[model samples]
Target: MADDYLVRIGKLIRDARQHRGWTQTQLAEALATSQSAVNRIERGNQNISLEMIARIGEALDSEIVSLGYSGPMHLRVVGGRRLSGSIDVKTSKNACVALLCASLLNKGRTVLRRVARIEEVYRLLEVLNSIGVRTRWINDGMDLEIAPPAHLDMEAIDADAARRTRSIIMFLGPLLHRLRQFKLPYAGGCDLGTRTIEPHMIALRRFGLDITATEGLYHAQVDRSIAPDRPIVLTERGDTVTENALLAAARHDGVTVIRNASSNYMVQDLCFFLEALGVRVDGIGTTTLTVHGVPAIDVDVDYSPSEDPVEAMSLLAAAVVTESELTIRRVPIEFL
Candidate 1:
């Protein structure tokens, strides 16, 4: 069994090196090892340490071996088994992740109630923890408490964790207020074709954020001297883009108006969260938002995000498909 595992790891390393168009000698030079060693490692003749595997992964910019990752999950469904019970929908996954990134805006503790413990959230937590943010699970692991440090160590961010979730782009809105310049790994998630970040850049540029993507890293520079002199118009009314604009505007210390924003459920949840942080938002369920930005936020806030409409709909669909009577609770009807 151990030999089989080693062979698989070796194959993965060989494939990744080939994908990068690097020869064995080139890879050996990159790792400061001999070509023969690389050949042995790729042929499973060498017993490579975990540290060496990690170094190879970093050098190739590939996930050779995910440490805690699980294999594909399978669900065997049996017919005639009715799922009939009271189902309580958890908070919106999109909103939870957006709020998690927004927590960086607050210096004091931020407690989120009943957060969805999805893999995306876990990845973001890993990135946050790596950047000097203190996070802990409380209340039987259903609640999350995030507290930012006095100084964020941006250089110590977990690039692997950041690359696994596309939501990491939301960090730009909050991090800009804290760090003048920093580098973030490019966002990665499900393969959904080429999703451009141009809309995000167009909106963020109003707040003096200039991003240059080079070599799988976004080099971000913020000019604090620049502020929105006029109403900022969004190029695309995307939910995350609107949230990013809101995040950038949250600390502008002026009345900033955003046009063509998304009035989706997640955006509303984020607006409510911003309000809790003492940033006044004029429009809650409208496309246009006038934000009264505060120069700083350092209050401990506890917020319970509303239930996800999509989850509630999924439960309803399951009940209908199985011909079972299920009581779905906490549906955000406003969104539907």
Candidate 2:
């Protein structure tokens, strides 16, 4: 519905451009779109991205969206900044969510070191607290401590928070151990194509996890008696799917080696945390992972995940864009 309305506005923009006797190339140059894109919008064909809409509006010297409905733009420049100060890398968000979900495996307290104080973590923490996980911030919200939750308070879940992140799907891996059946809100992340939860369900099905998507949430049921008869191979080399598989395997009482695993940055961080919890993870930096899941795992572990290369790139980009030089230390070049 919203898309239809937006496309209608594209036509209006095209018509306006035409009324001014502008060629498709001329209009494209004005709107910063390629001639093909301008042609598509004029024909009511192309589905526009938000970035396109902004550029078009800027080119047309007209406002596609109403004036009152916009957030202020923000940009910061360090001005060729080279840092002499030593800055410690913050924990990875990917690892933190996986660790938080895995914490349910333990009946004791879980303390995470230097957790990122970003919006995404706060959303997961909200969902955790709603599910009866006792999480608190120490050292001014830098250090996070979460106590084992008796069970997830399913009804109290923050739907908005859960829906705002793709990591919410990871909860399924840990939740299956604690509940026979539960539902998780559908994932939300980059505005990319529809990513199926089937990979997660398929990998976990070996562990007796049965999930069905309805409306907008993933409905799941776990048959504790069912364990994988052999190795689990992921359908795609996705990062989150691998984490879900690891979290499930972490509590499975046997030697489970995950084949075709994604040795991504987040996965490595999770492996580090799992190792700290006494779970043996072989092939830490490779596609194949041999996980020796311990039946009983109770340990106070504080593991620091390295910095995000994406954020570091963004900082470096800010420098390059403004003709500045910036030194980003502790960049996990492995991920880069």
* lDDT at 119, model 2: 84
lDDT of 2 by residue, 102-211 (tens): 77777677888777777888888888888788989887777888886665688788876887667888888777777899877767622112455678878999999987
Per-residue lDDT for 279 in model 1? Answer: 96
- Model 1 lDDT tens row, 1-336: 348877888889986775454689999999999999999898888899989999999998888977664788889977987887797888889999999999988989999999998999999999999999999999999899998999999999998788878898899999889989999877763221234477788888888888886555788999998899999999888999899999999999899999999999899999999999999999988999999999899999999988888878888888888999888888787735
Q: What is the lDDT of candidate 2?
A: 0.76
Candidate 2 clash total? 1
Best of the candidates, lDDT: 1
Candidate 2 regions off by >4 Å?
Answer: 1-85, 189-194, 311-336
User: How high is the lDDT of residue 129 in model 1?
Assistant: 96
Model 1's alpha-carbon lDDT is 0.88
| Model 1 TM-score on a 0 to 1 scale | 0.76
